[model samples]
Structure formats: C-alpha cells, structure tokens
Target: MSTKYKKLILSLILDAIGLIPIPFFDVVWAPASAYIMTKMYKSKEGKIAGILSFVEEIIPFSDIVPTFTIMWVYSYIINKEKVDTIVEA
Candidate 1:
C-alpha cells in the first residue's frame, strides 16, 4: 500500500484502539492523530486537521466520529484537489 493508505489505516486503527474503555486514551490518540494528519497531507488543511483531531479526540465521547479517517477520506478520496486549491488560495 501507498504511504497515504498506510497512514489512513494506522490512524483508523489507533482510533479504534482508543475506543477501549480506559481513561486518557484520548490523550494518547490525540497527538498520534495529529501527527498522522500532519504527515499525510502537509498543507494548511492538514495542519488544521491535526489540531482538530487532537481536540476532537481529547473531548469526552468525541472519538466516535473518527475524525482522522473522515479527514483522510475527504482529502484523498472525496475531494483531493479541493484541499490543495483551497490551501494555495
């Protein structure tokens, strides 16, 4: 698999693992998600995603949405060029 797919899968897996019913799993997930998000796209959107991923995972009960995966899909699948164009604008 490409590096991008690998990152997406890893982030999703981490998000899944963060679902374990334990305290402070979000703390671990947040930074990891942020790193993955920043690495994947390396644009303004990616930086924002990194911050949002951290925030989303840190909030209680917010991990249910899989922000990293959603961002990945949106950036790479749903509207890849849009992110670049918007970032460059």
Candidate 2:
C-alpha cells in the first residue's frame, strides 16, 4: 500500500478512537491526537488541521467531528482535484 492510503487508514482509526465516549478522555486525548495529526499530515495544512482537531476534541460532545478523516479527504480528494485541474490547465 502507498503512504497516502496508509495515512488514510490511520486517520480513520484515529477518528474512530476519538469517538470513545469515556468521560474526561478528551482532556488527555485531545493534545495527543493533535500532535499526531500534525506529524501525520505535516506542512501548514497539517498544522491548521491539528489545531482544529484539538479544539474539536476538547469541546464536549464534539469528538464526533472526525477531523483527521476530514483532513485526509481534503488533502487527497479535494486538494488533489484542484492540483489536477491546475496541471491540466
């Protein structure tokens, strides 16, 4: 498997883990997840998404946002289309 697909799978797993409903888990998981996001994605986009993930996880009941997966989609799907279009132009 390519690195991109590996990152996608990792993002899905991270998002699923974030969904755990254990009380106060967010307090500990939030920062760790954010760090993971930054390291996993890298670059400015990763930093931005990492911040968003941190905030989303920290807020009560907002862990369902799946920020990592969303970032993966944005990076691989949405951003890829834009790049392809630009190249085709």
Model 1: residues >4 Å from true position, as ranges?
A: 82-89
Candidate 2: pairs in clash: none
List the pairs of residues colliding in candidate 1: none
RMSD in Å for all candidates: 4.1, 5.2
- Lowest summed lDDT window (length 10), candidate 1: 80-89
Q: Indicate the TM-score of model 1.
A: 0.72
User: In model 2, which range of ten residues has the least summed lDDT?
Assistant: 80-89
Alpha-carbon RMSD, candidate 1: 4.1
| Top-lDDT candidate index | 2
- Local distance difference test, per candidate? 0.74, 0.83
Candidate 1 overall lDDT versus native: 0.74
**Per-residue alpha-carbon lDDT of candidate 1 for residues 1-89, written as tens digits (9 for 90 to 100):** 86667767876886686577688777887788788668765778778988988888888987787776787788778986675553211
Cα lDDT of model 2 by residue, 1-89, tens digit:
97677877899999999999998999999999999988876667888988999999999988889898898889888898543322110
Q: What lDDT does candidate 2 reach at residue 77?
A: 85
